[model samples]
Target: MKQPNIILIMTDQLRGDCLGYAGHPDVKTPYLDTLASKGVCFDRAYSACPSCIAARAALHTGMEQSHHGRLGYEDNVPWNYANTMAGELSKAGYYTQCVGKMHVHPLRNYLGFHNVDLHDGYLHAARYGSVPYRESQFVADDYFYWLKQELGVTADVTDTGIDCNSYLARPWMHEEKYHPTNWVTDRSLDFLRRRDPNRPFFLMASYLRPHPPFDAPQYYFDLYKDKPLREPFVGSWETEEYLRKDGRIFDSKTGPIDKELARQAMIGYYACITHLDHQIGRLIMALIEQEVYDDSVILFTSDHGEELCDHHMFRKSRPYEGSCHIPFLIAAGKNVLPDLKSSSTCHAVVELRDVMPTLLSIAGAQIPDSVDGSCLLPLTADPSASVRPWLHGEHSYGEFSNHWIVTETDKYIWHSATGQEQYFDLKEDPHELCDRIDDPDRQNRIHELRGHLIDCLKDRTEGMSDGSRLIPGRPYPVTLPHATAR
Candidate 1:
């Protein structure tokens, strides 16, 4: 049996319900929908840490947050994992390449990819005062360097007057072809043209869209601007105090209070997604053009999801569906695996950590003992097969820091700071509109879920659990002790 080429398509902050195949009403994702039709969509996939840095650590290392040591979002922490997805694949004789958004520390740390064409979008840490010229994004980022060459040195993505994390948006200041999303695809297509034909390749086309700066091509914005979009889901658990942030703030995590601005933000976000979808379409076509379409295994997912004003939240790092839930699908070419199901849906609980083992499994590589994730290829054939009973996720955001347990049908959240609890019947209220924490009928089930969380935290250094019950008000660190030791 020959090894198959693996293409991992990753998007930053893309919501699980924002795709056409996922039954989203407003977002148009024709290309992604087509891809999903030929793949198995994991309906319950989530990002355990629900932020860029931590989520990516899980993806690369194939370890849960506790093992990878990123409990939350923190930048500049060195990625020192001995075994990574790309590293293992390279060992298995695969030509590993990543095109965009490594999001790792040092800006240029390849994290074991044979080569990386880097572009981590508008990192504030890299652009801060007193930073060395070598570490600056302008010098470290390939796409930014190219943009300068094409449009002059002063040109930048920030020229649109939008903060990278801001919900404020507009079309690209330059032509569509120069957009970062296009550049990722452009470089990926170029890689296909020059890749060694004798060996199976592993390519990660990571896009930094639908995260923020909400800039998309005018055509995509136009597609959603006139459409009647749905309002953000506001749950009964929300309070005025929690939702009191001034939405006028450029990067308000509480989102825009102004309905019009919120609407525009949605337009920009959906447009970015559609624009990204088209770029993905281009790569799919290129795969076919290169005659590898029938021998490739393509998996698409996001690091985390955007809140997009859900529960009055705009950014990630929350334990809500809009923050942790992500789109996951694996489309294998007919020649790649025998009798693999297509146009299927899997209900098993899965996470970003699962990507490493799954891809290595597809490539016939030895699964490292250090990997905590399981192979997902089995679920592609048997959608009902169990991978795990439940998943535990957490983040260390200030005040709103929380731990959560999610299964196929429900979710239980515990805010570590205040010890506030929220439970939702995901099957009944997919939008998480009602909080069922105190409901008499649901307490037993909630207790069981809480026990799962307790077990997950009992052995941790944070003292979040004392073996029996969760301990609130415990000091939380973004990176755990293991990460610090590294």
Candidate 2:
């Protein structure tokens, strides 16, 4: 069998439920729908960690947070531990390239690809702050430079999304402006057209839109104006902290979501997704035009999911399905693998870490045992391919990290800072509308899942660092200011 080339497509802050094929009536993801008709779609794909840097570090490096150590927004992933997909492919005599937002810190540094044109999925306030590279090497932030040169746009421009609206809300809703997703796609297409085809190649195209600033081109925004956006999941305001954030996103009008604002935000998100879909379509066409489509495996996913006001939250930072779930579809070389569901959804709980091994497996490459996730090739080919029943997600909020484990029967979440515990019977209450932690009727099931979660933590987490207050699987930096001296 000829080794298949890989082209991975990643969109920032996209959700598993947003695509039209995923039962989202309003969002028009035609290309994705067509691809799904011929490929496999993992309906319950989840992030290992909900935050961008940490989650993506795990995905790219094929290691847990403790192993790679990118635990927060600004934290860096250790590039020395092992080979990433790019590194592995490069060693196997394939030319690997990256051309979009990969939140793994040091831009092209931790990324082991041969060719890199890096960008962040969203505008990082840290871009102008500190980094290993000089200004010229900061490609994601170059949007500002490019926008100024091309559109003469400035930072002082007041976005209509935030400024003044009574019926509508969300800080950046009215502020229409140039966004990073659009630019990432443009640059990626440029790379695709100009790519050298001498060596079988692997290129990652990452998008930054639908993540924040909720900005989009006028045509995209207009395209989704009348689409029926998915409604907020029930019990969205159950958590006091969540309620507080909701107030802030709507009150000050600097950031947040209201009912209508959230609706329009969905349209903006759909617009960005449609924009991304078009770019993806163009890339697929480029691959066909270049005649590389026959021997290549195309994988589409995202770092994690956007809250999209799913649970009265504007962004992802929790263990809920909305925050952790994502869209993962793979087309195995000119449609070798027959479509399993014809726009189907897999119920298996898959972690982002699994992506590395699966991609390597399909490429006929060996994945190091040190990497934790199992190869998902079998699952893709046969819908009955089984994986872990539980998908765990961990995240740090303001220096505090919370751990959660989701199983087929129940869900368990634990916040280390306050020792807050939450339990939900997912089989019964799919939306997590009620907390069943204290429900004695299901205490036995909760305890069983709790033990399972502890076992999972034991198996995946490395060990506790008494000084850092972190367990094995999750890691935190000692100097993040929130880290007080012992």
Question: Which candidate gets the maximum TM-score versus the true structure?
Answer: 1
Error of 2 at 30 (Å): 1.0
lDDT of 1 by residue, 147-198 (tens): 9999999999999999988988788878999999999999999999999999
TM-score of each: 0.98, 0.83
Model 1: lDDT equals 0.93
Off by over 4 Å in 1: 484-486
Cα lDDT, all candidates? 0.93, 0.65
In candidate 2, stretches whose alpha carbon ends up further than 4 angstroms from where it belongs are 76-79, 121-125, 128-145, 152-179, 226-228, 236-246, 249-257, 335-344, 456-486
